[model samples]
Target: MAVLIGLAAALAGPGGTAHAAVPDSPAVTYTNPVAEQRADPHIFKHTDGYYYFTATVPEYDRIVLRRATTIQGLSTAPETTIWTKHAAGVMGAHIWAPEIHFIDGKWYVYFAAGSTSDVWAIRMYVLEGTGANPLTATWTEKGQIRTTWESFSLDATTFVVNGVRYLAWAQRNPSEDNNTSVFIAKLANPWTISGTPAELSRPTLSWETVGYKVNEGPALIQHGGKVFLTYSASATDANYCLGMLTASATADLTNPASWTKSQSPVFRSSAATSQYGPGHNSFTTSEDGRSDILVYHDRGYKDITGDPLNDPNRRTRVQKVYWKADGTPDFGIPVADGVTPKRFSSYNFADRFVRHWEYRARIEANVSPLADSQFRVVTGLAGGGTVSLESANLPGYYLRHKNFEVWLEKNDGTTAFASDASFHQRAGLADAAGVSYESVNYPGRYLRHYDYLLYVQTPGTATDRADATFHAQ
Candidate 1:
């Protein structure tokens, strides 16, 4: 596992030509495990300027929620228990995987629960909130959804496409071998399934059938003309991973033939990152609303004594999601713990991203093996709105300027080192949507790559500005 160290470092000395003092404006950043023992995480940013969060508590007894103005604020936000399980009837035991959503000016919570007599007989249920704020709203219990069979069902999520609302979930078909499969159906309303359910995907892949044949926790996100449904598979242990299903945005969502499943898992456990059994993920935009962030839960340690559920270390974590050239989402490896970072892809050359080769900054093809290119955008050494880039693969080393050249080096604490490491992060001087790194010491000079080598240069034309522009992941 990669050790997470502090971002604070000593300022460089005189004539060192690299490090500078830490910035005055605190860096806008957040760490992983926003909350502890919170699994099956879900976060949504509403128009009211708050990011609401809910997840499966380790006890699995009730639904709790929290909201904050910023993503980082959720860590300390007070939790509110909006609803509790029934004492003996249907919604009585094993309350799990609660997701809160606002629909038609009201709030609805879709969750899985089981009867007290039959604790394992889990099924989906809903709670309608009547007030404006979900935390203070009155929740009315909606009964279990009747599916094709009274079998095991859970993980209900809703989304709208074009003008139609649909519900997607996981269920055990009577004819199948006790394996959970993913299903989708058009919604009559927020809590009811209007039509027959269509089985979108089954646990047929080898990875999906690992400890147990499973496919659950369906999350939907639409882009362009494609509907992306991501789900968790296998047992809820180290074997747990994420799989994806895709369908056309205009396709009949109730038709089983319309959806296509991936042969392998899209996201999974990473021993190097100290995150095991990483699954049941949700998606939301960044605080800036310009990037898509993946929210999920995972065990911090690999080894567990008894059942993985009892371990209770499945902490909620978040990371930025990137995109491929073909427009498909690229959820890289589960990152190592600490502050997750981003990659800067050149605007002029979209395929090339800024990376380090032998401690020297360079532009390389942005491909599958992405760790080398990822860097943490930390507070710059020089104060006044400047920022520094710290390498993801090589911790403690940062991108610093020396002799008008960008170099990845270990901060040795010197005035020159501090001055060279600081750069003002700004909107792309060329492309408004893109970004540019202007040197704090050199003033108008910006970080740009020529012949794949990074250097500080003054831009005088559109092409020069384009060379200095980059799309940060």
Candidate 2:
């Protein structure tokens, strides 16, 4: 599910000219914290061409809904207070993690709430919304969702596979003294659990067991014939992170044995990036509806004065999700702040990505610690209207031509580096769906790999063009 730009033959430049053009399918650049003070985010894109967003507000008193034609629009979209906690009773206090879902022509919101008498008496609840627009619709309380020994239950999510609907949530078993664990069961109705619940995962790893042996916030995504259920673990502080469970699309989801838990977290805090406790994520699609995006919340800083729950800086962020060759997701690191860039993979070698080895350009297998392979595709050198590839890990260094060879060199703000670094992005001469990078100065000569090393050479035949084409992922 990586965002990719296909190769094109037309030469267009950065300034919207024909000298060298940006990728025909340009990358959608966006900043982090799409909305402030929004935690446990859930973004659902409906068929009506609008993305609906809901999450736990800092006050933890009510559920809110916002919709936008584009993802970025949610940042400024006016939020409607769809439902509030009851003055007394089961849902009278501490409303949290509200997710809006449209099922069977009716909209249902699954959320967690506590009692005004006892805030620790947390349980799952549902709100039914009727009408075309959720903002203007009427929401009615559907009462508490009864589960198998729900000592502390919350974060309810649902998904369907092979026409069978299933519900997954975080709950504490009566026999267990530790934190919550993930459970799954077949759903007879939106609010009714039909069968016995089976345990899918618990906090076992050191990362998950940190601060507290907790597992909560189960979100589901079905891709590549597989179901991936990601849940948050540990305390809601810096130790809070994301873990995942995988099962085949055809497998019996109701059986706990069908799902396998990841030994390590799939996504977590990135101290270098200033993103802490990145968990409680929901999955949605890009504007083009061609890429899967991960929507989650994380604190900007690590330090907090009082209880982490009281620190209301957790903001919503979105990034594209990439899949490994084996069809599993590679969440990589919680990326740094700013417009996230993409990686380049060779068309001839699907597993190999364009990277730097000793500051020299080469193609290698896409593996863990993916920062080395990522590059910021920016406007070309000297304002020549082309494009330049800047290293993600090494900010000042860029891919430049030296002696007709590509190398990662530091940007010295010199004319030579600027000219050598520029490249004309064009469509694949061999593979029409792929992309080819031709040297801006050399014109006909293109960037190609030979014996794993990248060099500038004129493509003569289909084989030469194929070797030169790359997928901008």
Candidate 3:
């Protein structure tokens, strides 16, 4: 985690270069565990210009909600308990994973609950909210959403594709040995399933069957001509992770054959970041609606005492979701705890990003510990309306140019060091859409990667301009 040296150091611009505004870029800084003790997190950015948040509380006794205009505001947003579980019958115990959605101008919450008598007999249920503000809206209880079977079921999420609504969830098949499988069905309405559900994915891969053969928490996002369904797998401990299923947007979604499951988990626990059991994710767009954000929950520690379900340490977190050249989402890894950092992606080599390896700065793709590539774009250390790049995981260290070569070095609090560390933010030399960094001391020299190594070089050709230009994301 980077340490703040002064007020100016903390006063960085939000997620873009100072010269030009980039629409829909991520916020400059947001602390992790956006909401504490909140698991199975879900975030819904509605047309009302607010981000609605819901999750399984540690108590697991009621459905609660909160809203904020921005993702950062959600951390301190006051929560309102809109509904509670029944005493003993249906929707009575283990109230969990409540996801609020707006369907056909009405607000609906899809959640899972168990009977008090049979605490493990969980089933999916719904609640309807009457108005624009779900926090203050009149919520009416709508009974359980009947699936094909009455056995163990949970984590129900809904989405619409080509004007047709579909509900996807996890349910146990009595005939199968696996704990649960992901299923999808057409939704006649927000609270009712119209036809038989198709089993899209099950836990068969080694990573999926880590502690238990489980597949649950189905969340969908349609992008790059494909419908991507992501779900949690394995037991809810250090082994818990996320798996994905991909299908063509035009395919018959109800048919299992349409979806192709990834052989490995798409996202998983990152020991380097100290985030364990990272799964059960929801997606929301940035305030500008340009960047996609990954919202999920994980514990800061790896071990749990007794049952993982009883542990209350799981906390809600959010990070920007990157994309691959192939147009698929690149989750990267769970970042280190601190102000959420940004990765400077090369405009020319979209796959490569600014990273530090062995204290030397360079641009590389798929760097390990990901924190090595993440940097806090803070206000200038030299105080000249410039910016300084601070290492995300290395406190007090920054990217400083020495002998024209950029290296990760600890702050020495000297004028020369500060001047060497600061850079004048400039609009991209090659592409106006991105940004280029000019050295504060050397007026014409700009930061660029040569042979994958970072250096301050004066641009003389188109290739140098392309190499100097980067998108801060």
Candidate 4:
């Protein structure tokens, strides 16, 4: 969501204090690649007020954990190798996808490992920690988790619904044609699954069969009285994406009939944003517990030499999650590289977003080259208490007004350009939670979309006010 400041009555000149309901503070911003070379990332925020993070290290030699007070801080948080791989035998090689969770007043880590003699002999394992802090806690190996006919398995995650705990994961069933499929079962405890495991999804769609017929990395989140389960599809290349299954909160989660799969992938690689093979995501909330964040791994560039798994450039990234009116999430596109850009959706036209096409500014839905719709709200070029909207794709170009029409133009480093490009951000004319931008040079004129085109005008009607408002997220 937009980092918005409440509108106050007071107005100020350049270099003066900006008016807002709260005191002025710098916007919380972060760049992509929250953690480098960390794939299959998972983040768990605990009650003690720290976000615990873990992922697959490229070397596959050990399980590491880190904690930070904020999501962005996870980038630099010193990671501790809680458990190293065995010298031989079980849990010796191919260690992957470690997820840390707080359960029943203790910490549990669910991960997959293979033996040195047979690197692909993957199976799920559990590690228990009894102390308040997992980093310092003495961990005990719980050995391999027994699943129903686990030919090959990994990416185990556990969640609670009502009072019953459940374990969800991806495992290869010898009877199935697909390489792997997602399964869910009621958990007898953190390390054991009870009853028969129900297969929630299999790789049957064309998108799921790219390079490999796979459905792995299952992550779950519940909202709007529904439980959403997302899993990775395809091979670990640019074709990797996310597919989801939905079930009612009250449904019998273990019964395969209770779940419905989405026909299309929920999130995927974005050529425009330069994020390749985006999948294996875990959800967490913002520091203030106000917004949901998607944490996953992707390579910055598309082309990789040899096998994608051996490339070792998959970096963990995070982006804000926006919800539709129907209470479902719109992952949108993987954002452009710098400053975690946001797309401004028109308040009245929820489907339409403020975007630039051929340097012309307008509001359009399903914008081609989606990056054109994203903008970074940076400090104003005029250096006053104002802001400037910089195009995400075109780094140096900004949205500026000329003859009342908005256009994306390059910063020519002139006073006229700065004045035209800068705007005084105010509370949304239609909704205080949203935002409205008033032109710096043209007082009383605000940025509004009319006839699908962007303009600086004095909105006089309710519809006009709504059109003037935009949600930047």
Return the TM-score for each candidate structure.
0.82, 0.86, 0.85, 0.84
Q: Compared with the true structure, what per-residue lDDT tens digits does model 3 show for residues 434-453?
A: 88999999999999988888
Most accurate candidate by TM-score: 2
Candidate lDDT (C-alpha), each: 0.82, 0.83, 0.86, 0.86
Candidate 2 lDDT: 0.83
Point out the worst 10-residue segment of candidate 2 by lDDT: 12-21
Over the stretch 1-473, how does candidate 4's per-residue lDDT look in tens digits? 12112323253212332222321111235788799999999999998899999999999999999999988889899999999999999999999999999888889999999998999999999999989999999999988889988589999999998778999999999998889999999988899889999999999999999999999999888888888999999999999999999998999999989999999988888776688899999999878776778888988888888998798888899887666557677676676666787778776665678999989999887675556787888889987799999987777899999999999999999999999999999998877877999999998899998888899999886666776888765
Tens digits of per-residue lDDT, candidate 1, 78-152, equal 999999888888899888999989999889999999898999899999999998789999989877877888999
lDDT, candidate 2, 217-294, per-residue tens: 998888889999999999898888999999999999988889898988899887756788999999998898767788
Ordered from best to worst lDDT, the candidate numbers read: 3, 4, 2, 1
Error of 3 at 68 (Å): 0.9
**Better candidate number, 1 or 2, judged by TM-score:** 2
Ten-residue region with minimum lDDT total, candidate 4: 17-26
